[model samples]
Target: MATLSYNPSKLRNHKPQSHKPISSLSKPIKIPFSSSQFSTLYPSKFSKLRLNSVSESSVSLPTNQPPLTSASENNFNEDEEVDDDPTSEVSYLDSETDPENIIEWELDFCSRPILDIRGKKVWELVVCDGTLSLQFTKKDSIFQVANADNYNKGLQELGIKPVPSKRCLSLLLWLEERYETVYMRHPGFQVGAKPLLALDNPFPMDLPENLIGEKWAFVQLPFSAVQEEVSSLEERFAFGASLDLDLLGIEIDDKTLIPGIAVASSRAKPLAAWMNGLEVCSLEADLAKASLVLSVGISTRYVYATYKKSVATTQEAEAWEEAKKTCGGLHFLAIQENLDSDDCVGFWLLLDLPPPPV
Candidate 1:
């Protein structure tokens, strides 16, 4: 969006927005989400809106947390803090008693813009727990999900805090079903549907020789800038592809600088265009192999950069470590003509979400 230009100099004087710190949270690990969730994960028309507007809003962990109604929710006391630690050991002996035995549920809050009965636009929140239970049944006047206060207050009334992130899986499925079984049958609703890219194998393919960049460097950018820049990206961009950074169990503010890698090349545009075709995932380091890897199309992997493991490459390893600790393994790959140029040819936000639990 906006002709892919990044001014590195701006970061020097950049003052990040004020928000809750990641360390302030009671727990630091996200509840483990299921790999099966990927099958239903698709970007709807509301994706870009959510990503641009409330991407930084407080979110609940998706994994190992149960959705509680007024009656069953009594298990969690008001004084006892609910810990949705993703690293906890799970025993399958009792699903009801074992926190780890519970599967992660997807939630979507107010991200979908829909028309109400009076033709007024409204945002709705859909919360589904591990058992596929719905918390708030009244869809007539659901609270606006963007305001974090409204979200938490509604949950607090029901004895829940930091409600789960509404990733909008249920809404996506309903829309898809409606389009196929209902809408397609009608002439007026026969318009093109939103493009969907399902997660493939996590492995990434090596870039074609011609698509390789002339130079690359590890760099950082403000989360707000990334969110702001993507809004203007044309139809050729992958705006909806993202992993729950909340999965990192850390809340990042708009001003938080996101660490990533930048590539400068004469063929930047084409390189970016090619990536648009694949489901680009995350950038990671293979310390044992002394190589930088890019994960795309689900399980597919690619060798982005390789170096000898020695004192010379020590900084490379350190960058990877710091990024993992700071951003929940989230990173980026930006293709540009040169390091100094403000205009970027392509930018891809990469996330290193944890693998599914066994």
Candidate 2:
């Protein structure tokens, strides 16, 4: 306590301790952080560096690894790849060996005869590989043969041998059958390989008095009569007699047959006009008054006309018999008599009439 009494002079002589301002300080000291602490504090920057490193490593990796094989590829060997080459002859053999790859030989036959835009005959056959197109006229040498034996002989004369393959032979037979059927049935050849007559040519007029009336008469011969040449159409039309008339050419059932001629009477002007406009050879004649329809049936290749009258009197039967007798001589026959009936009596007549000229 006695030694501390003289401190006032020393305190008075000592200046206040100097203090530095905050702005005058140099760079601040940094504290080192642990990995977890750095990541938590600056997650985006850490993540970016980590992504860049991974990308660099991936880009530097080698890319020469083998390609993966598919299930279909695994089914066949590497040698099978060579067989798919189309240019190689081995591919053909490969196709022949594998039933799945084999192309089946086919012939797509046409049911109806084909015609061109100009109505010229055109034959078509679709083979397995492609189409076989052909056109021939009745004047062709191949058509001159009357029967199969003659046809084969003609082919032999032409140095064309029968095809070796049985399948091909069958196809040829089918073709021949089609050709014969077409030759027989086609309208162009229906009149025994003769050219079709012009429409303007007047039909034969000198028929029997019974068959010919003031309004109507039989005109053309039946298709069968023309083909078989049973009697000349000219003679039949000029002089009527009991000639063989057949409806065999019509491709329809006999039981449901109703064949008749539609007469253009003075009252049937509208119908005539319509028929003329249509330019058709045959038409349904239910509306016409002068039409005579007869129920027809095939009796031994001959078409017989039948009539059913309400009153079966002797006179009526005799008249019917006379009408039938008149029709018997000519192929296309129509009676002048009319019946009393309220029902519609006309339907389609599937006669082998020629189509109107183009």
Candidate 3:
């Protein structure tokens, strides 16, 4: 038999076979690897590995395979998971139960109209807001008084009938009695042409039974008495308070009954402007004669005055000094006459009564 000799150059010159397109493949190709080899290579356990053909965009994951999570993520606490959830409802019971969250309601006063039984004009009193609406009759009183003709004329312009002077007087008396109940416990009254009214009740409807019975009273004073008695009382008393009475336009001879609200001295102004027609020199002279030592208290609504009573005791003097330190001291000092006396007069002289002991 004759053996055919093949040259290496002939094989090199031969054309190679063409490959088929991957899109023509019927199924995904398998990646051949042993379990031990995979463990050694990747340090992870995976079964039945598959690879997509070149024509496919992505590989299909096995349904039985667990998602790959990092060690840090796997170790996360359960609380953190709950916090991460946006829909989680947080409890605020701790904050709600805190004592700091509790707030005391404060009383605020305003002015309102007083209508008679016939819904006509009754002389308007500077009363608390809710009080008039609650206490006054809705109907207008038939009795008309001639004394308030000017007032009645003004009311007639507004289409309101005038209330009789007799009826008006009766209503005033009744209102005073009613207000006494409301203000008896309170320290003083705030009096002015336009005073604040109580639009809403300061106390909650569900307040404790004991608190419901608590009452406040108004300290009614005449403008003249305030002017005369205030200086004398300050001279005699160790304690005094400041108030803002500039809006009142109180004249020396005017018989305006100014109501003062009871408030802590701290709330009072350090100095106030003197009401219209008040003589500064006379007031200063009065204050100087008494050698008055003034100390402001908690509220500015009323000033407390008491006679010095044979010189202040050592303890009382010390206490007055301390109060002066705490409450910004008296508006006027006997030695400090050249200072702003008008400001001192306006702010410090609310009333001429001695304050109750702290």
- Candidate 2 lDDT by residue in tens digits, 1-358: 0000112223112111111221111122121212221110111111110000112112111244223222243353333322221111110111113333424332322222433233444333323211111111111112222434564576589675543221221223234443453434433332322222223333222322222222332112223322222233233232111221221112212111122332312333333233222212222211122223332111011111122223222233333223223332122332212211111111122232222111
- Residues 1-358 of candidate 1: C-alpha lDDT, one tens digit per residue: 0112234444223221111211111112122222222222232311211110111111222344443333233443424433322111111121234444435444444322223334433334444333332222112234454454665777679665352221333433434433343334422232433332332344546756755666665556666666544543554353234433332233566655566666666767777777666667677766677667776543567888765567545554565456454655556666666656554567665655443210
What is residue 241's positional error in candidate 2, in angstroms? 24
Clashes of each: 19, 0, 48
Candidate 3 per-residue C-alpha lDDT over 1-358 given as tens digits, one digit per residue, 9 for 90 to 100: 0001112233112111111121111121122212221111111111111111111111112335343222233452323322221111111111113333423111111121333233343232221111111121111122335423544576679675432211121223333333333223222222232312222112212322221111111122334444443444456442343232332112232233332212112112322211111211111111222222221212211112222323222233333333223222111221111121111122224323221111
TM-score pick, better of 1 and 2: 1
Off by over 4 Å in 1: 1-206, 235-250
Compared with the true structure, model 3 gives a TM-score of 0.17
**Candidate 2 — which pairs collide?**
none
RMSD of each: 19.8, 48.4, 44.5
TM-score attained by model 2? 0.18
From the highest lDDT down, the ranking of the candidates is 1, 2, 3
**Per-model CA lDDT versus the true structure:** 0.44, 0.24, 0.24
Which prediction has more favorable lDDT, 1 or 2? Answer: 1
